[model samples]
Target: MRRSPFTTLGGSGFDGSQDAEARLRWFEHVMRRDMDAPVRRLSRMVSGEVEDVIACDVVNPDHIDVEFDSIGGLESIKQALYELVILPMRRPELFSHGKLLGPQKGVLLYGPPGTGKTMLAKAIAKESGAVFINVRISNLMSKWFGDAQKLVAAVFSLAHKLQPAIIFIDEVDSFLGQRKTSDHEALTNMKTEFMALWDGFTTDQNARVMVLAATNRPSELDEAILRRLPQAFEIGFPDRKERAEILKVILSGEKVEDNIDYDRIASLCDGYTGSDLFELCKKAAYFPIRDLLNDEKSGKPSKEPRPLSESDLEKVIATSKKTQVAANEYNSLRSQLVGLSRQTETDDYPVQAAISELSKLVVSQILNLQAENQDS
Candidate 1:
């Protein structure tokens, strides 16, 4: 008595009359029925209105190439992520005993720019084996009045359907900044709806969805948003040893001279971020090529560029100057953070810790600047 799936497509299926898109949709609908329960659940969760938008942000674990080991430093942060986020999703049974042991609903990774926050998020997506929703502000915004809220609602709904999902938002402070009276009503509603859904997911102990956000400006986040993100990790700049390690990672597999002293390079490139170090390496690598081009321009015989040497790196480092934070700029940021820390009513441990770290970094930079000035 059962009818064929092809028959349900109306008329003769695969007759070439239907458009390619329509036929593909029909085929997908038919194939989804036989998929595993989780896939079926995910399919059912995406409503027609938000399906296209949500689908664009869904990142498959296999496609993500980043891994924890690939990141040069931040061992502590990696371990914390494993304990708080990865372990729970990988083995839920261990956390099922009580609500206290359950994974955090939201986590915030905050620190200076170029501190590998985005890289860490990618590593989590790859290592956790969870569905990663790389949310972007553009993806949630809509020109229509009510559509924006619906998009925000759909994000959580889709995330719930895909349990063990990580909804990562890079530069989260921009999207969920401090609520202000001058803000547009639509933007305000979107933030409120986002928080409502976030809280809703927290009540479901069995739900494995997590909101993983990274921000350079933690103080700009709203109070309620901060409350939701209880587990905050500061991805500060790498120390001397870490900088050496980062250098090794950056120069790995490259043609380099045996006399290249990474320790000397690390010591010389003080206060350079991982990104800045990478840029330094890139410029050093170009030294050999620049020579080769010069040789070609003249009547000299063409030859392969020599391997990168310590002098090459040192030359680039000598020319490259790290941008120092201006006194006024530093003071403005420090005052804002000092004000934020003075709020005695709220438990602002994260903000306080960030301020402490910022002070150390600034002091170090000032000393380095003074030393450079004396040398000059």
Candidate 2:
């Protein structure tokens, strides 16, 4: 006869009370041997579920094709990120002295649209060799109630598992904006949960996780969110020199004439953003192709199109207008704000009202410019 596996538990055969007792003993023995099996299985199930939900958002540093060198201008911003984010993450031992010296839990990158804020975040991910979780608002939302909160929790849990991770939220103002009473319950709960997890990470001195957010309208963010992001950098428009450098970088890979005056092109691009410069270059590049097509259509034997010339860039510049907030107008408004503050101290000229009026005017002008750009 075949022997039963439970025979080791003092079982002789399937007979009577002794056999029942032996079975009981065998059950207890098995439980003792694998007591933690269920717990381990539960933990793995939860982890696998979280991974399934957010696996698409996780990005390895090696896959991020951006580098700090590829980004033009913003040298100061790059240096700041290198020191504050990359260095600490790369050499945590150097920053393990105290809570104050530990890596920042949250960093905000605020600027106008197309100022390379997102690009900078990617460069940081690439340079720091940290896992980048590109958190989108859609990823957290769920049709089922209470799931949003769980998803939010999952984000932090995943980030914790993948230590030395950067959770990058582009246009974060839309995600964690100033909370209103009319806000959806799910959204409010998700935001609360997100902030709570963000604060929780700070208690662990060794955790290299960081929340990196970018927005054009920082003022729209909730006060609590801003408080968590103590380290904020303003990525404003590039200056004339920076614009020239940007043009050079954009055209570096293009077939362009050596005599193309980048300085003049930059000057013409006055209030243009980095994105605007790239579009300008893109439009100019087509000129050569257009000429080649014309030559072919006319039955003229053309070996190849001529290299992009200064006149080609000039033509594009003449037609293209700056789509960003006018630098001069922005500077003027800033000066007025400063002057208003000074006047508040010296002369009581209804400073608050004047400041409010100036703020409104700035907003209206920006809106009008946006509308004009969209229309064009």
User: Highest TM-score among the candidates is held by which one?
Assistant: 1
lDDT of each: 0.79, 0.78
- Per-residue lDDT over 279-313 for candidate 1, one digit per residue giving the tens place of the 0 to 100 score: 88998999899899999999789998989999988
Error of 2 at 257 (Å): 1.2
Residue 185, model 1: Cα distance from true site in angstroms = 0.7
**Model 1: ten consecutive residues of lowest lDDT:** 3-12
Clashes of each: 0, 0
| lDDT for model 2 | 0.78
Poorest stretch of ten by lDDT in candidate 2: 3-12
Which sections of candidate 1 miss by over 4 Å?
A: 1-47, 299-303, 323-376
